[model samples]
Target: MNAFKSKTEFAQTSVFKLPHSFLNFDNFVSVMTRAHLDRAYWNTLLIIVAAVIGNVALGTMVAYVLGRFEFRLKKLIMGTYIALSFVPMITTQVATFTVVKNLHLYNTLWAAIVLNLGTSVLQLFIYLQFLRNIPRELDEAAMMEGASLFRIYRTIIFPLLTPATATIIIIKTINIYNDMFTPYLYMPAQKLTVVSTSLMNFSSERSTEWEMMSAAILMIMVPIIVLYLFFQKYVFAGIVNGAVK
Candidate 1:
């Protein structure tokens, strides 16, 4: 069959090309050095870490208040968050960019990090799901023992939210890692290239070298693949647990 022959030919070509392409570290090194990717890696790491912390802390607190407390404006607040989630991020890019420029954060790593610090509605919903599974009796008991709200969150609620937190971290890490648009738009300096934007170096207006491009893609993919493999169980666990309630 033609299909079978085509598949065979593709496999053979991949086997022949990929081995040589992947093994050639010169291209990888050249790309990294030329793009100043070492600095980029540090910048990306800082942004991811800082944004994850901010997202988790803020998201958890909001979910905790919305889930565990009874306030007059609760429904309105929840509705606002749900409504905002329906708005597409791309539609607001011009306004967002304007705000970033006005704030004097353009072309700075903090700009990316600050933009990502907002509470993720999905993460908040996940936290709310996990929060529902935790009985109110724990809070009551902790309160009876003179534990402040902060103490309860830190000592009890926070520990129980670990699985969900891990899931959020993994998801956000991948999102931030593959995000080329924000880094390219906000941090255009050649020295500020993240992994995603650095891949642009492989192609141009005239021609694209497929082998080098393939190599660069694999290099970009390796870290994410390794992270997923390592933390896959937590991701599944969070999904399963969150689905239960």
Candidate 2:
């Protein structure tokens, strides 16, 4: 068929031109050395680790308190969180940028990390759903064993929230990894480039080199792909358990 022949010709001309493109370490080295991607990788890793820890710890603690305890302003607080979720983040960019600027964190990595630490409503909701299934009797039992509130949370509630934690980590990892706009906007310095923004180096006003771009993309994808492969079971388990009961 003409279609088959065209496909074969295209593949031969394009992919086979640099048969070693995917396997070549030279492109990777070029990207890393030329762009100073080693520094960018470190910067990105630090941001992801800090952001995930803050998001998980803060989100989990808030969810635990909101789910387990009844307070006067519980409804109001929950309503506020839910309402804020409905407001698109893009709408608040101006205000957020202003705060970051005033804090003198505009070009710093902390700006990205701090802004992202705010608890995600979706993650909070998932935690609350999982919490509903965990009997309060466990807390009572632990308390009878001389466990304080913090002790109960640390030993009992926190351990039981593993699946939800894993889910949040996986989700947050992907989001933070692929997020180009925030890093681009907040980290304008060449040295502050993250993986997503670093890809821009392959493009220019005159022409874009598709071959190098593909190579760079594959390099960037390797870490996330490996991460998902390892944690996929936990992700599925978390989704199901969080949603079902």
Q: Write the per-residue lDDT of candidate 2 for residues 156-217, one digit (tens) a residue.
A: 88888888899999989999999998999998999789989988898999976555566578
| Model 1: how far residue 9 lies from native, Å | 16
| lDDT, candidate 1, 83-161, per-residue tens | 9999998899999999999999999988889888888667777888899989999999999999999899989998899
Worst 10 residues of 1 by lDDT: 1-10
Q: State candidate 2's TM-score.
A: 0.88
Q: Which stretches of candidate 2 lie over 4 Å from their true place?
A: 1-12, 15-24
Error of 2 at 218 (Å): 0.5
Question: Pick by lDDT: which candidate is best?
Answer: 2
